[model samples]
Target chain A: MKPTTLRSFLPRPAINQRICISRVSRGYAVQAPGNPTLQVFNRNTKYLQKERAASNVERSRQADYLKDEVAMRLSERLLDINRHFNHVLDLGANSCNIARALTLPDPDIDPSKTTSPPLSTRISHLTAADSSRTLLYRDVDLPFNQEINLTRQVLDDEERLPFEAETFDAVLSSLSMHWINDLPSQLAQINHVLKPDSPFIAAMFGGDTLYELRTSLQLSDQERRGGVATHVSPLADVRDMGGLLQKAGFKMLTVDVDDIIVDFPDTFSLMRDLQAMGESNAVLGREPGGIQKDVLLANEGIYRELHGNEDGTLPATFRMIYMIGWKEGPNQAKPLPRGSGQINIKDILGGGEVK
Target chain B: MPTRISPIEKFAKAAAKCSVESSAYGKCIVVDYNSVHKDKCLTEFLRLKNCYLAAAKKP
Candidate 1:
């Protein structure tokens, strides 16, 4: 494969360049509310959390297992689609996990021989955008010999997308949408930005994610403090995903749920890992005080007692909801009209002749 | 049928009206983000939450 310069594929417009420069100089600002929109997660706090995680090189590296696993799984789904995307967008691309998954050769592939093409051969260019500048630039200098043309943009997922309509051939996100406040609107924005018939594939934390931790925290908090505060941010349910995508004007929707269980030595270790992963609770109006010492202790005991594994390891479930939707277009497949079939279903099923 | 407004959107709208309370609670948390415990800013948070609910009830 010949090396393609980023400039050769797409030229940067003067106006776009000026916008980028201005955005960089001003830093990211919260959306100026024209119409009243509800705020779910505090974007400023979330950005700070991600920035803190990115600053910790060691902890962040260890916490990347989850992102790496999810990224690979999402990429597999993308590869199943039999089309070459000329320009793809990786939305909420923290640490560029999707980019790494696409560009790097699989472990099974031999490095010496040029017999097999890299996975990224299907995409000619990738744009990685993240709300947190630090996380977006975390792996900027990583050496990938077969790297595809990539552009990094610091963008808040909550705000309106800066790109024009029907710009990207495909838009993919991994483990990001859960933090979005208005998910339906976000999905609509994604659908608007995709070229006709192009796919939007994403994986996010489902409602059942961290049930053990959530339950334990609630139980402990209720017992100790007489009331429970919002410790864990609410996530989207698998059942509602189809409706959301359809409401966003996406056709031919597919939603699947998967669970990844990770073993931690204790509850404290798990919580620390979550922080390192930039997955801390950012729910608005959440209890400001840290988890009380007594509550923490009680929560640990409750967590182990309720959900502990046999070998003394605590199991934490990360429920992932994967969804695929395509923008409507003339070239896409269409189902037949109602009652269009000529053959009777009874004959096919060998059930007797129709009266 | 008209689309029903989601509970999240309702809560968010209410929260938007209580920006002062919300920011006060948020500031308390940010001040001691790493070492925050239960009930550290309970008063501020509860005030914000109450304001949110109250605001949400109107219309």
Candidate 2:
């Protein structure tokens, strides 16, 4: 967090911006022939589509509290920037939760605590894009007129955004980036479409997400089958995301973590909730044939014993990593050139003399 | 213009270069198919990758 670190860590805006442009001159170079090694996420679009379909069905039956929470929180953070966006794109806009949050503030929800202006006032147009065809058509039931503000809902994959360069003024993604197979390259795609100095804010589950469930499942599999299988998809660590943003040619970057712990009656209900949320284990390396009955039961016991609360409910932790990065531009802040500091750190710390 | 490959395909291609004979565990890449499920995971991964490519081709 030191100034020196920031200077070294962040790419110089003006120079790096041009460099980024040249590097991505041809747009996303995803499939070079004979490369043979670019499988980042499971990239199982069938499973991904199925998961989104199931979540869409669940959304009709019950509200998605987690998605709504993330959307609202992201909205709050976007407003904190105090910049009005003429056009904003919501990537992986599952059911347009973030779009709704941006377009309309709930009437029933308390507004007394909200001091800043509503996001709707600032954004002239909003586009919600998602890979799930169902989510693209799903009813968000927004209070605002969709035609006026929520301009477009497109069904598209995040990995390859079909947009011209420097299109949007701002971009927001919630709880979706983690599923991307190649996040860095995809982030570069994001960087490509954004206008210079525009902000891109995203939130995804961190490495610590579902730690309790993962540990219990591992213990159960080990005790019952004498080996552990992949029950949870690997999550991105917060520490790693900062470097990714920088690598993607972003400036003035920030990454932080937020933890949400929900209590369930039992492991069964926890698993059900995960399914309903479209967050089931879809790792390609996962043990095939699914969890056996014995292992599942054992996992329940272990989960209850280890993470259960006094109220007979078990804890499920979700660590969300939030990141904000600005597309490099001349307007963005840049660190002073090295050896330009007037005050020496040693002088302040009462250390050695000037060299 | 050069043909633009999908990000997943690019990652899959990069993964092929790594012949560690075990899971490639990292922040960006985590392929446990070679380690745990062996050929099953790898086969399925290839099939899925092809599906992604085919799907990407349509419109």
DockQ by candidate, in order:
0.02, 0.02
Score candidate 2 by TM-score against the native: 0.70
Worst 10 residues of 1 chain A by lDDT: A293-302
Q: Fnat of candidate 2, please?
A: 0.00
The whole-model lDDT of each prediction reads 0.81, 0.70
Q: What digit string (tens of lDDT, one per residue) describes model 1 on residues A318-344?
A: 999999999999878877789999998
- In candidate 2 chain B, what residue range of length 10 has the lowest lDDT sum? B21-30
Q: What is the lDDT of residue A195 in candidate 1?
A: 95
Candidate 1 chain B weakest ten by summed lDDT: B6-15
Tens-digit per-residue lDDT, B30-59, candidate 2: 222123322323343344345444544554
Best model per lDDT: 1
Model 2 chain A worst lDDT run, 10 consecutive residues: A54-63
lDDT of 2 by residue, A1-355 (tens): 6455557676678987888889887677677675253554565643464446555564433536788888888888875676778989989877777876765553334567665445777888888887775655566554554533775555455678998899999999998888887877889999999999999999999889999888777765654566778888888898899998999999888899999888876666666666666666777777666677545544554565566688867788989899999999886788779999999788789896557
Tell me the deviation in Å of residue A221 in model 2. 0.8
Misplaced by over 4 Å in model 1 are A1-36, A106-115, A339-355, B1-59
DockQ of 1: 0.02
RMSD of 2: 18.6
Candidate 2's C-alpha runs over 4 A off are A1-37, A45-63, A104-117, A140-142, A145-148, A343-355, B1-59
